[model samples]
Target: MQTAVGVFGGEGYKDGIEVPPLMVANAGQSDRPEISSLNCPPFVAVELCREHLGVHPCDRRRSINEYRSLFPAIDFSLIENDDDVLWKADTREKNEEVAARGLKFLSWLWTRKEKEIAIVTHSGFLYHTLSAFGSDCHPSVKDEICKHFANCELRSVVIIDRSMMGSDPATTNYPGKIPSGLDLPSDVADEKLPDEGKVN
Candidate 1:
């Protein structure tokens, strides 16, 4: 069965890592399914999707400006901030707020029967969304999921149904339930992550 997998870009990717050629080749499949993102680095993911999957994103944004020569056939959206709020905000609640916007997009995508779908965004946003895929999740479990993803890493799941997703999607930052050693949203607010590295 064809699987839709999200590919994180290697912008600030640690060790100068790049998306695997095999993954890029897989994304270049003949089906040409729609790719999606939160309007920033996901455009980098879009480029990956087109370069690897042979599909174009459903909505386009200008984040892929650097790839004009490589992905000449791709048409980018002129819409400003179409994929906003995923990581731009400072507070956990604000972050969750934008993530909910992303969740809404995914829940809508789940309605389609297209065997696979891919989303590309920064590690932090990706971690939050992945954790939200489970029910009654423990903070440790969420922490574990958040810690595992690295730049250009591709993680896939068989979402028979979005069992973990709610009618109204929200982020699981647990701002009010902070663990003892974890950094608070404010503490990490100004932290600038390289597009190519693991968030942790």
Candidate 2:
């Protein structure tokens, strides 16, 4: 008999955390029958898949998925955390207590299995988010990200998700759930949100 395990844990503070015995048994247990076609330092820079998630209302801010998209390959089943919605812009439904309204179709982008993804959004989102690239680069590079993208102007950029670069692929984010509500498509019920001590 043999076993293998991968723990993709991030820094966090929680009141109570527990592990199932089944997982404790797999500490050194990875024997993936198939090696991922992806190479070491996994990354995709070609043939991006253009995705459409329909449309939804929004008063835009850095979306919850924006944080995760920076590392899209981390399998979702292993993650466990809350949906941080405080940054919500008053751009859509006024229910600040509920962040799903702002997310609309955005969450779907993260679920797609394609390694190369193309996101289509307004200039405002591109302007602010691209700023995350930092201003220390070449003047033109800084100018491109900082400037409003003119109509039909296309720029090539690279995003890095360190998790996929050289880490074991079998890790997990624990009890994390996106949209914070299991029913992301329908109205998110308040109760479905994870209880503080139970899920954090």
Which candidate number maximizes lDDT?
1
Candidate 2, which ten residues in sequence have the lowest lDDT sum? 45-54
lDDT of 1 by residue, 1-200 (tens): 11222332222223544332212323434443333322213232322121111122322333434333333323345323434322222323344543565566566656656676555455555655555653444444446555646766676644444234433333333434434543323324235333423575
Q: TM-score for each prediction?
A: 0.38, 0.29
Q: What TM-score should be assigned to candidate 2?
A: 0.29
**lDDT score for candidate 2 against the true structure:** 0.34
Full-model lDDT for every candidate: 0.40, 0.34
| C-alpha lDDT of residue 49 in model 1 | 21
RMSD of every candidate to native, in Å, equals 16.3, 23.3
Candidate 2 lDDT tens digits, 5-37: 112222232345432222222223443221221
